[model samples]
Target: MSQSNQQRIWQVVSQIPKGKIASYGQVAAQAGIPQAARLVGNVLRKLPEGSKLPWHRVVNSQRKISFPIGSPAYQEQRQRLLAEGVVFNKETIAINHLAWSS
Candidate 1:
């Protein structure tokens, strides 16, 4: 990706603070690219393992973690968020109380 496009994606990721969450579409929109929702997911998936970008705080439009059961990423993300007091309803997080500012 070009430097500018990389920066744009990072700009959106950087705005997501600790203990907060934003949907892919919202992040794309906030970055001034409304149609880049799936692109946002792709960019996030490509982030290096151990990035400080708070990648765990993002999820699908349904507010559920996307990784498959037993997957390391899924378990780690759920554990991390729960450690931060994020409440979940089965696969979905309670967005009304947990939705982040965009």
Candidate 2:
């Protein structure tokens, strides 16, 4: 069930605290779908309006915001993360700083 999988991924993502972030792979693994990291991302990309999921807490393996700067999603994600005290360096959320441990 796509809806179930998306909900599961969101649950795992919600566990990440403010100012912290998880790799999509890490969230997928935590959600019992270790190979579905990209799926997690895809599902998140489909989240509808008013969804309360903390999707901004999920990033790429390199702890970078993979969304392009010109995209609205990219702006929202960056703003949300920054509001949560996440600091970025040279276009990436410094992996050394925000990478949440498994």
Candidate 3:
């Protein structure tokens, strides 16, 4: 993706408040790149180490972490969300209650 597109995705992600989440597709749409959900994931995956962007706040459309269950990445994402007061029901987040509308 172009730098501008990546920046747009990052900016939108940064706006997702603590305790709220957005789908990859939702982040793409909010960045004005409709139909580019995978692009959002790619951009997030490339974020630099120690970056302040809330990459963990973006999940699959089902509101589940995209990392394989039981993986370190999955655990980290779940932990971060939980720390932010996001509730999960089993492996899926309570999206209706925690989705970021913006």
Candidate 4:
């Protein structure tokens, strides 16, 4: 994806409200690339540290964090979600309850 597309993805991600999450596919759709869900992940992974974008709010379609179990990224993502009051059912987030529609 071009830099502009990535920026658009970042802009869309930044708008996700606190306590709500969006699937990677949803972020891609909002960014005007409906089929680029994996691309959304790529863009997020490349985000600079301390970015204002809410990268943790982007989850898989199954409402799970994309990081591997026991990894630092997984732990951090879980921490951020919990801090935002996002409830998880086992390994899956309760996305139906907390998904941001816009």
**TM-score, per-candidate, Cα-based:** 0.80, 0.82, 0.89, 0.88
Q: How well is each residue in 21-99 modelled by candidate 3, as lDDT tens digits?
A: 9999999999999999999999999889999999999999998999999999999999999888888877878654645
**Top of the candidates by TM-score:** 3
lDDT (C-alpha) at residue 48 in model 3: 95
Q: Ten consecutive residues with minimal summed lDDT in candidate 1? A: 93-102
Model 1 C-alpha lDDT per residue in residues 49-86, reported as the tens digit of each score: 77888777777788888788669989998887787677
TM-score-based ranking = 3, 4, 2, 1
TM-score of 3: 0.89
Worst 10 residues of 4 by lDDT: 93-102
> Which residue runs of candidate 3 sit more than 4 Å off their true CA positions?
1-3, 95-102
How big is the positional error of residue 32 in model 2, measured in Å on the Cα after superposition?
0.9
Best by lDDT: 3
lDDT of each: 0.77, 0.82, 0.89, 0.88
Clashes of each: 0, 0, 0, 0
What TM value does model 2 have? 0.82
Residue 20, model 2: Cα distance from true site in angstroms = 0.9
lDDT of 3: 0.89
User: Which candidate would rank higher by TM-score, 1 or 4?
Assistant: 4
* Candidates 1 and 3, the one with greater TM-score: 3
